[model samples]
Target: DEVFTGDERWRGLPVPAGDRFAWEPESTYIRRAPYFDGMPKTPEPIADIRAGRVLCLLGDSITTDHISPAGSIRKTSPAGQYLVAHAVQPVDFNSYGSRRGNHEVMVRGTFANVRLKNLLAPGTEGPVTVHLPDGEQMTIYDASVKYLREGVPLIVIAGQEYGSGSSRDWAAKGPRLLGVRAVIAQSYERIHRSNLVGMGILPLQFLANDTPASLGLSGKESFDIVGLADVLAEGFPRGKDVEVKATRPDGSGVRFKANVRIDTPQELQYYRHGGILEYVLRQLRDAGR
Candidate 1:
């Protein structure tokens, strides 16, 4: 009893008291998320995706680890550069899992597995992609930055079992932050599909046994997800069939149908409101009225 009573090491620690906890701006471990930044009381209407560029073309069995790596951060990676710029040494740069609270790091770590093979940048491995309309080869994070700067939406094309490994939330959150508006894949791991919707990313599945290879999608064409504007106007019909048109530089295009992957009515509601966070915020704001 004396030994237990004598422990006063933490008694003098400071305790913060406030209605809203102040986030430390200088701390890299946990930063304020920008998910609700500029969020309006009501969501704008969801529109069709036009002229979307393929960010990466991946093969089958791509795991959540491939989408959001949790291992040691490379000194040359975008996430590493961010930390270094903030005066953190390479030795202090921790694994991605350890820094998950920081969106800046996690977003850069998306699709950054050292073993990942993005077919868009052939013969190269690990977080590399080719920016469209210029054929400029750069890191996936860099290309995403360029694409976002140019006001272009991004998409990822993949074969079967996409997001097949551990159910990591960052797998979905990271892609959404990288300006990836949609993912068209042969199949998706169940939880990852839900996560995608939870992050306000449209998940589409190819129809009629269609594959990107069968459709001759070279990953360089400009894609338009047709019927989304109409579907959103008509209330985002569940599992609606939508046409995808991939137009090449020559102006010729291939069209195919894909099924929306929003499975439940609640998921549809979340997607319509631009994600669960936004939906819940509006709900709370309106409830007081």
Candidate 2:
């Protein structure tokens, strides 16, 4: 009777309850499902994210499009090839847009299809080249894994409109998966920048013509964002300068300033919680109390 009354009340409301009102039926079905028998479920490991130390940035003339494409995908791309290699049914491979939900798929796709030449691979002086655990000239993805394994932090340096194009969350999600803790750029596209913050990746802006060239940063240099906790604790107000120390490949270091983009008190909460999803889920779980 309580269930029926709850359902009626839900349906009578102006806003649609959709599938939420079917929770009782769904729970019943889940209990009876064959695969529901004594399965061990593991919680997501949210505490493992440490601050990155070794920063790598690979971008080309069309870097923004590569990082966050405008739409869809062709069957011949690296992402498509990876899916095919894994025996994903042809239709299931789908568009890049559809596959963002899978971290493995998105990380493999990060620098796979970018037409711009990788700046950190061997035979380049642009930035220090990172050798992959694999013997190949390391792509950005490979190098990221190596750095992550070594317990080194990472940041991405980009030119104008760092994240442009579609509002797909994967554009930001992929970097977080790769262990990038921050991104410094000349400028950022609005939606992607917000998405980066949502994923708990610090989006920093370089002011006063402090381009990668001006700062002389290459892929080989490591970066440290000192006083990160202090900035977050004090509230990341606009015009707040966070110190970014860049170590060059030649063992020289340069110190530059970046503006913190954490614009609101709510955003600070998200950063403290590791991400927006974790923050919201924690809130929801607590609300039941």
Report backbone clashes per prediction. Answer: 0, 6
Q: Model 2, residue 236: displacement in angstroms?
A: 3.6
lDDT of 1 by residue, 26-87 (tens): 88889998999988878888889999999999999999999999999999999999999999
Instruction: For candidate 2, list the clashing residue pairs, or say none.
Output: 52-153, 53-152, 53-153, 54-153, 127-219, 128-220
The segments of candidate 2 whose C-alpha lies over 4 angstroms from its true place after superposition are: 1-64, 70-85, 89-92, 122-129, 132-136
Largest lDDT belongs to which candidate?
1
Model 2, range 87-165, lDDT digits (tens) per residue?
A: 7656776665565544555665664544544455535532133553233454556567777677776777777776765
TM-score of each: 0.95, 0.71
Report, for every candidate in turn, its global Cα lDDT versus the true structure: 0.92, 0.62
